[model samples]
Target: MRISKRNLILGIIAIILIIIISILLIKQFSKDEKPDIKVDEKKQDTLIYNTNVEGIANINNIYIYGMHLNLSGEVNTTSDISSIELVLFNKSDKKRYNLEYEYIDNKVKFYLSNKINEGIYLDEILKGEYQVLLKITSSDEVIRYYSLNNNTAYSYMDYYTITRNGKNNYIEISTLSTQMVIRVTEKTLPKDVYDITIDPGHGGDDPGAVKNDIYESYINLEVALKLKKELENLGLKVKITRTGDYNPGNIAGISPYGKGGRVAIGYETKSKLFLSVHSNNLPLYPQNNGVEIYTSTNNNKQLASLIASNIVKETKINYSSKKQDKVMNGVYVRNFTTSEINTFKREAKENNYKFYETINTKTQYYYVIRETGGIITGAYVDGRNKDYSANLYYNSNIGLDGYLIEMGYITNSNDLKILLNKKNQYAIAIKNAVKEYLNITN
Candidate 1:
């Protein structure tokens, strides 16, 4: 068994090569196949570097709704940036998706909402855990940093966005740690935990749109409770603002989005959608009646038309004749007007309070609609007013898709009769709309 040194070296090399080939084959034959990253590995290596650019490049907020996401921060780098892209990097298989972004005035903004028609869609993505990061290509250096987690980004940290399809998909966007992480799993959620919240406006001390022998508060509760029951029956989890006659959040004369209040309940429940039920009143025009649904003027109007159409078709309600803030057949977006903004500005000055710059003419007048919008729809409740409680979820990126439904005017004889009588019909209409929106099937 005398062997030459060269022969022994050749044998050792062959064994090493066979082991490497076998490992490669095993990886290729594995059940799970990950999508490959197109970029060169050497170039991609720079992305994980923890370069503390601080004020120069930072992500301040991360907002999520269903599959829709909006990220905001500032990038005040002195380097000449040629391009910027949002990177969804998965550490497991080195998978990544680079998305388009907007960088203006050193302020960075990114959107993953198909409604905005600008960013990535969850449907096009693969199931995996991914970390959000910014990749800024500049003359000086390529900056890659994890989406920074801010102080107020905790509201919807545990929220999950489930999809409807041949097979179900679950998406959880978390900022529990320093960086924002998105975990996409394929599983059905639990039934007992709710994802939709229904708010019946006006309760207890404040009776909304009261009329002789008929109170709007009781009528709203009646409709909302029915709606809750129907939604649950349809296999959807539902939470109401007030199960009975008392309000959960702060009372009226204060903000509706106040702590434990109407709008706050939606965020607290981590709801994907929230509906506020109310009966309208117009003493000036007693004949004014019909259904009107309100959504944030700044957000999408898809839910508005769906719910409005269903209510009108299924119930005895008519289209609202009060067309002041009407945006469509039965939908309305009652944000602040320029005149109203001026009045508020004056009042702010007189009261020695600082007016929020976010309260422009486009800002929603109804706190239920506005404050539940999170950062996407310019929601702002930063504790300015001493008389009212601050909205805890005002700065949340994970806001509830909220709507207000004014069933009918209480002053109108015919409309009032339908409001008081056709409670089940209204509930059925809303439940149908919810099913349609969620793409739920039996």
Candidate 2:
């Protein structure tokens, strides 16, 4: 078969073109068959980079609680680290943050603040879960990623745990049984142990005052628990004397460290302020009702007044003011024989007690007032005579302020109604008073 040279050349070119198209079709088919091939290629790239890199950075024991983030671990590299920074992502809001850091002892601590940027505060960050990228800049940059949302176990880290030391709660992370503590706060916490001590009066065997099936001990504990929660929410550390129905032991003639017994707990916890919640009782006069606050001394009269005023204003309950001495002048004592009078007087002198047959008495004479230590009120003696003095001046000598709140008279039906029905309102009132007293803006 004789053919032209041009025809032969055209046939060769067509064959070459068909071969190229077939190769393209085979490659497209392979791609369709293995969709994950691209991912494998990317992983290969990462593996190669990691092997070539001499220095590696690691994030161990990452902890996020409240507004604080703690990162601990070592970055091993030949090159010195020039800078270290964090990139935080709010998964819910899709907002991102870039935080600079200074490392100490192979650990970095970051505080999230709105002052850092708009809506980047701890409260806002705590509103949702976040993911973080820790970037370490040396001769080359190394990134270690972590997530606050996941429970997935990683090789070098254990799940976080929470614990409380006295009043402050801490979120802790550990690696190989070594723990790193992360303190959560809106602002830097005070170095002092705690801001307030809430003493729930008359616990365990001592059920304070009991009337109409209402236990004052129960009421005191309930109110104290609520107050603790409220103050903690405000970022204040608060301690309670009895988490359950237990006392620290007696004080003086009173059990559980009678009089200033609670002061011992305050001292142990290093509490700055003390509050004893209690229910009042008037067995002689059932008509005596309303709220009364007894300060350990005159110094804390202002704190007492603040609490009293708030309760009265919120609940519309009467404020039971301390009575004046002249108000009870018309009252008289029984005419006793000389022998009987001598016996009573002898006992009174021995106890250094005053026989007051009248209504007027100093509220500060109570043991809780005299003994509760810390920044508290002074002992108040109603009379000038030392023999008849009721005040022990226990708290006053130390310049600590303590207050006993007589929430309401459990003996009076009217007061009982408010105490039982409006218990939460009373708590709120007390919380407001505490906020004002502490000068807390939030």
Candidate 3:
């Protein structure tokens, strides 16, 4: 159509401006906008891992223990998903890492570690502050970014140790404003800073055993404190699980494998020896007396023997009269019975967890001995047990040499008296045994 020259020029300019505005609007809408979680400082506990994708993405549980970080979530969408991955971004260095993951039936589980081509990923380059994003791609090639939240049924402070050239890089995962964040810090442990970790078993609400008026937690702590002093007197550095009357390991939950508890203390300290001092209770057989020294099957029994012998001699408490799993007069290597193994298998099946082939009748029944040994000692709990969280350091090649000591039967009159009165004697025996075994001249 014929028109005036100025009018036509103005008309083209208007059209161009209109087109540019439309393009800018489209780009703005296409950009990935992060969902606001509105994490209240006080109400952080109510926050859960829910991506603001309507009903498309919601993470149920995230198991971060030892050298692995596992996640299980649901993709509540009718459309088929092409793939799901965990995206890691380092802002300080402008680096990015795409983590491979496994997803099926709206469930996701994978390892986030420092090794390559194995369940444990050992990439030291994964350092600095990481902003974690869950990348879910649909079959239609549409991509969505989700902020991984801290609603994994409990609070957690995950420490994934990455070792290289005899040093450790602790990959700590924590939640910031309801989103998951990873911070990698290099730590150099001293040669003999921590020689032993003495655990006063069942602190706070968890009293190991109970009698007329005695609490096992109190006895354990008393003995542990004394033992700590004894070991220190011999020029050995010691770390006790808990000093106060509360459960140090039960931060957000009971005995969380990596974050809290005796296992966490043992793993974190990287101590040479881990001694869990606990009292036994046989309510039905109140006549049972004396000490029971527990050592795993694969462990060296020299320490156990020394502790048993020295404790008996020093405290004048003979070996346990019970014949179950007895290796010597006072020493025992307690393992899962056949019936217990069957029960474990059944429980795993019911709970939808992988039944560990590593666990058998010979596997240590005590979590302190078994879970502290890592993969070498068949530490198979990977956050499968609903009651206890995953043992984070369960698969580490470098772990602690753990031993559990039953001071005496708390239910027995004779044993209870010694356990309450002769805590120092028991501590001295354990200390002497450790000195002889380790050849600590100091």
Candidate 4:
């Protein structure tokens, strides 16, 4: 307390210096505790794929029938695919087109532009082969290219008509040229003393109607065999076109050789009549149940009626009024212009007998009836709502007298049950009808 003035001033200066130094240290410590404000300068990694070179097209299921090309496949990669198109290159012109495609079930399908209306007619297109490619483009601006290979070919050349039988028309394209054709060897017509030729419709590849596990072909064969045995027992000569699950010439329906072989057998045996046995199933109308008898021409109406009467009596099933025996006029082509008719006539000569008859005015009947000489009582139910009709007359009398018997509708639960359970009864009914027709009193 009694210190000199110089001593007090020195103490005051020392305390101020201590306070400033302490303030500076405090500020420096605060600066160190504050977090650094550094902007993030990192980027994300993206995956990119290359598709510049040719690769095995990722094609799964692709089939080319005539001019029609069916394509189906899945994209295995994770890239966003914007479009997948089929590219067709005409060998002659080297022309290309990106045909429209539809995506369904993780697959794409398209027809080459000219072959676009439902399906393209190969004959209408060029005569030579064309290069096919599948091109896929992704949202990331990458295009994947694939080359298509043809695996299936047509059996005949010079343009085989799709309507081998009297069914609908379809075009067939062969990978091989016409020069490499394999003709269906001609068959010799037979001459035996057979009174009747029984045909069990649809064998081998053609499985007519199918429901659950039941096949129409199976039922037709069963009934046909039973009838054959009955006819033999009645002391009448009988011949059945097919004895097993296979068709003649391994062809289904009335292919040139298949139908020709069967007919040749009949002609060789001198068979007086032909009859086809078939079963029915309606995909749209499962409730339809009945027995039907059909005659291709008026000449066979009585025969059809006799058989139908017996079938109803035996199976105790309702007879379809729509299936009543009648002469159906079979028009080869409907709504044809004069020029089209002339063209059709000219084309008919190049076709086989079946194809010719299909194009020309022929007896309008079920294929079996129209071509093989008989009526086809197709099973009653159909996807379309309409009355069933058959073809009646033909320009040429090549078809033999015939009738078609649709024993019962396989689509109906009750009918199918009866067809499966009471097959023998139905056979007996047909036998009785044949006996009546022959005037044989056993």
Better of 2 and 3 by lDDT: 3
TM-score of each: 0.70, 0.45, 0.57, 0.45
Per-residue alpha-carbon lDDT of candidate 3 for residues 399-441, written as tens digits (9 for 90 to 100):
5667899989999999988998999999899999988876555
Candidate 1 local lDDT, 123-197, one digit each (tens): 445676666666666766765454544545352454455434434456666664446556677766555335688
Candidate 1: which stretches are off by over 4 Å? 1-61, 71-127, 131-156, 162-181, 186-193, 251-255, 382-387
Candidate 1 vs candidate 2: the lDDT winner is 1
Q: Name the better of 2 and 3 by TM-score.
A: 3
Candidate 2 lDDT tens digits, 239-332: 7877777654432244433234465565444454678888888877778777777653224144567888888887778866335311211111
For model 1, give the RMSD to the true fold. 11.9
Per-residue lDDT of candidate 4, residues 1-442 (tens digit): 5999999999999999999999999999878656332211111000111123255344343332222333343433444677766543332223334545555564554434322111233323433334445567778879775554333232222222221112122223222321111112212222344567888877777778998988898999998999899887876667898898876534533341232455445444445567778888787888777777765322425456778778888888777534333233111111234566466566545542222333333333355554443211111111121122112222212234556778878888888888898888888998888777656665
- Sort the candidates on lDDT, descending order: 1, 3, 4, 2
True-vs-predicted CA distance for residue 411, candidate 2, Å: 0.6
lDDT of each: 0.71, 0.52, 0.69, 0.53
For lDDT, candidate 1 versus 3, the one ahead is 1
RMSD of every prediction: 11.9, 21.5, 18.0, 28.4
